[model samples]
Target: MRILTIIAATLGLWIAATGVSHAEATYAPQKVVYHINGTGGENGAGYKPALNNISNHISAVGADNLDLRVVMHGDGLGLLQAAIDDQQLQGIIAGLKNDGVQFLVCKNTLTGRNIDPETDLFDVWPEDIVPSGVAELGKLQAEGFAYIKP
Candidate 1:
């Protein structure tokens, strides 16, 4: 647990150092979409390390240079609810949002689960809801965004 925290902190530091860095963004155009459909009662903790990987990515490349998206569907809907269940995760999602990380949720998931997008989902906008998460992934991939499961 301690090691994971340390690593997460390090990743956050790296992300902070970049600060929407344009140089890194212009140097290498990295467009990645993180696909998450966690099983086993999915939530933010299910892939907290994955968040670190994204931050590390920005650190390695640059936020301005990277077109990063975290598309969550199926059980992954738990990510938006994670902070609601565990208050500790409150700012985690907010931080990613601040760094311009696009958090997309499936409309199907929302409808199937009967979750109200505006109220149930934390800080989710209408634009963030996609018709189908899987289809969105395909569209994004076709657009040249690298798909990352982790």
Candidate 2:
């Protein structure tokens, strides 16, 4: 029993020292798109939870091992609008973006809603605007990205 305990401790230390752990085995590389079509609630509560979920996802999968996208359209555009004023949301978004998560906005929604991406949205670039949210979602799915609506 004593020898077995010592061997176990040494093996564990060796694994840690070598940076070889179960995390790699536990999480496979993933391509995922999160669909957001509605604002969750008032006071940014609607999208805050969704953002939290996205953060938790990056934490679990490890940013380097994940290819993640957030596609927003319709009422979902409310998220960016809220972020424009909410510093907390902006921080969260910046962190997610730093983690390589892409936030894609729908152009159709912007046009129909008469939202000028330059002023109405938060940190949205021309490159971030998609022709259509739903269509982009379909394209992503067809490209082997797992679709998640939350």
Candidate 3:
């Protein structure tokens, strides 16, 4: 009976090991787009929480295996406002960018607000400015990128 118990335990261990290995073998890269249209004072503050989720995702899948982009338009353009108003907020954005996060601003919002994307936005370049935020979201999804709002 003791020998039989030992065999059963060995088999259980083998099964558990294989199950873990199978799960790890299924790892796949992820592409995600985060949509933010809330103003900085309230809605913009939500970026921190969204960023936390992104960090957790990268932790689970590894940074090199993750493609993440943030689209900011409408009142959401206020996200950059905190960074503009405070140097600390600017550092926060810089840190995230270092982690391969992409921040895309909307040209339509900039034009409507008479804000210059090149000069007014921090670390924002011409390429970072999409023609329209909503349209960009659609394009990203069509390109096989999953969408999230925070």
lDDT of 2 by residue, 1-150 (tens): 999999989988887888754444359999999999996578567898889999998888888888999999999999999888889999999999999999999999999999999998889999999999999999999999999998
Inter-residue clash pairs, candidate 1: 25-65
Best by lDDT: 2
Q: Give the 10-residue window scoring lowest on summed lDDT in candidate 2.
A: 17-26
* Model 3: colliding residue pairs: 37-76
Per-residue CA lDDT of model 3 for 37-117, tens digit only, reads 975565346667766776776667666677889999997777786567667667777877887989999989999998876
- Model 1 lDDT tens row, 30-73: 88999888852545666677778877877677666778999999
Best by TM-score: 2
**Cα lDDT over the full model 2:** 0.91
Give the local distance difference test score of model 3. 0.79
Residue 123 error, candidate 2, Å: 0.8
| Segments in model 1 whose C-alpha atoms lie over 4 Å from true places | 1-27, 40-44
Query: Backbone clashes per model, in order?
Result: 1, 2, 1
TM-scores of all predicted structures: 0.77, 0.88, 0.76
